[model samples]
Target: MQRVMAMRLRLLQRPVRIVAQSNAAFSTKAPEFSDIVYGQDTGVRTVQFNRPEKLNALTLPMAMHLTQRLHKIEANKTVNAVVFSGNGGKAFCAGGDIRALADNGKDPATRHGEDYVADVPKSQALKGQGLGTYLALTGERLKGHEVIGLGLATHYLPTSEYETLVHYLTGLEFADHVPQEQRDEMIHEALEELETDEAFQEIDPEYLETVESVFGALNDNDTMEGIFERLEKLNTEWSQETLATLKKMSPLSLKVTLEQMRQGAVKTCAECFQMEYRMATRMMENPDFFEGVRSVVVDKDRNPKWSKRDITKVTAKEVEAFFKPLDKDQELILYPSATAVTEKEE
Candidate 1:
């Protein structure tokens, strides 16, 4: 893990120049994406996850397709910003498809192996490391307000004003080199439309309180060991509920998730993706992950019989193994441009 982190730091030391290009020569037609809607009007490009029946549960192929589309968007100078939403008005995304992970009937080798797990989480972590760990481990769905409160989303809108927001975005026109304040003003006006809705206002406090309480508890400890220890000692109703929830999850996953979140704080987004690729590959070999998917997704039984029921029994050595690199061919390969710029550099 230290060697990988050192390698990442060395990679960042090298300088690369990015020359801005004009979009006039590029194609205007939106590229087709599987399980996604891609469209552009004026300067705004919108990407909508389109699997309503499954609550927009992202599959491996869907994630890869979306990633490819986003790369294309990055190179297109016509797009000012992107508006991401989900079809069916229920959820933006329900995270990965656990049922697909558990299903080994058609292609057993491809479905349940080091390769399968590495591929899925590698794509997800490239987008955001913290959210990937939380979603992959707990399978907890986030609604509009929760998503916004977590800083994963910039704006929140009620379902009623969804079309209005899209229309407003599509109507917007910007100069080739627009002022930041002008963009902010346009966004402020679009957000103002949702402020008038009583339902949207009502959800705000509840989600904010939820985020505060959970994060406050998490902040009480500096390390994952200390955090879990504090959690075990707490007597409050929320603490008890949280502990019960943790008990239900796979022990291996919980340990891996904690390490993922811990490393995410220090690692670049691209580095975190590489780390997740290694951790997830090892997780697939463990029986608990398959059992977790079987109980929650396949059978809908809500009872997963984990290999190690008690968190304390999950050895530190066991957790450490997940961080080791995979074979050269199996490792995640990140694009140089995907490396994030640190706040200090800005």
Candidate 2:
């Protein structure tokens, strides 16, 4: 525990800058970091991550620094907006370079040992689009026509028109002379004009069939082991690759993700975020997230010795515990303010 706290302190020390709302309103001083730069416009603050050689891979300190800068921005009333950018031309981010462990740890629910999960799908379904929610929660990425078909994207403009769209948005940003509704119309029209018929093309029947057979089966899986066994029976290249991917992930994370996806399908967007916050808190307490980061990203070993190596060893009770309600005071309250729950539900 001392080691964890020491490592955390080491990571919190870094160089970062923020456009102060005012000099008098802040008490915290900027840390000494060379990899980040901050700039300001009339009412905009620009934060540029400056690790071009490392593809702007965010160190733990950088994350802590960015959090501080964000807090300062939040306290200031004068700052109109903030923009994040990367200094490199190659990649925007290479992900975080994390250490072995960062936070708390816990054992399984009731069993006191991580129980190998074997559970059944709930017979009842939600009022919302559960499959869509499940696909997102399980992180089943959709590309090209798949994205449009899954309602994941509203606009599918061509590569050629990207620059044009950016320019139009930038010009409109400075053109406050335009009314808000007119501005909205102009943006919508610009995207529509740049769109291609490629987006409207019918999804392949074979693709739908595969999705039904694969993802559909996954949805009905009782446990991670069941999912793997189901995949192994398919004995195809895609199934093999999929198993490899899942194995690379933290076992505990997989369990949490499974439970969250099932819950989020019927949940409000705010409710989903709240549920995720609980899951994230529990994951931090699980150590597997940090271990996953160390083995997969920082160490490059690609071998994470999870606390529980086997999915069948994971319990349905254990998975559900991660989503249990936190103490009342710690709960996320999205409906407290006027703009609360403002974003559209996915």
- TM, every model: 0.68, 0.61
lDDT of 2 by residue, 20-50 (tens): 2443532222425777777644334557788
Q: Whole-model lDDT, candidate 1?
A: 0.61
Q: Given candidate 2, what's the lDDT at residue 294?
A: 68
lDDT per residue (tens digit) for residues 88-198 in model 1: 877777777767765642354663333253343332342323344445445566666655555655666566666656554565556656676666665564565444333
* Residue 223 Cα positional deviation in candidate 1, in Å, after optimal superposition: 7.0
lDDT minimum window of 10 residues, candidate 2: 111-120
- Which parts of model 1 are misplaced by more than 4 Å? 1-34, 104-152, 175-185, 196-229, 338-346
Q: Give the TM-score of candidate 1.
A: 0.68
RMSD to the true structure for each prediction, in A, is 12.5, 13.8
Residue pairs clashing in model 2 are: 15-32, 15-33, 105-285, 115-313, 116-312, 116-313, 116-314, 117-314
**What is the number of residue pairs that collide in model 1?**
0
Clashes of each: 0, 8
**What lDDT score is found at residue 127 in candidate 2?**
21
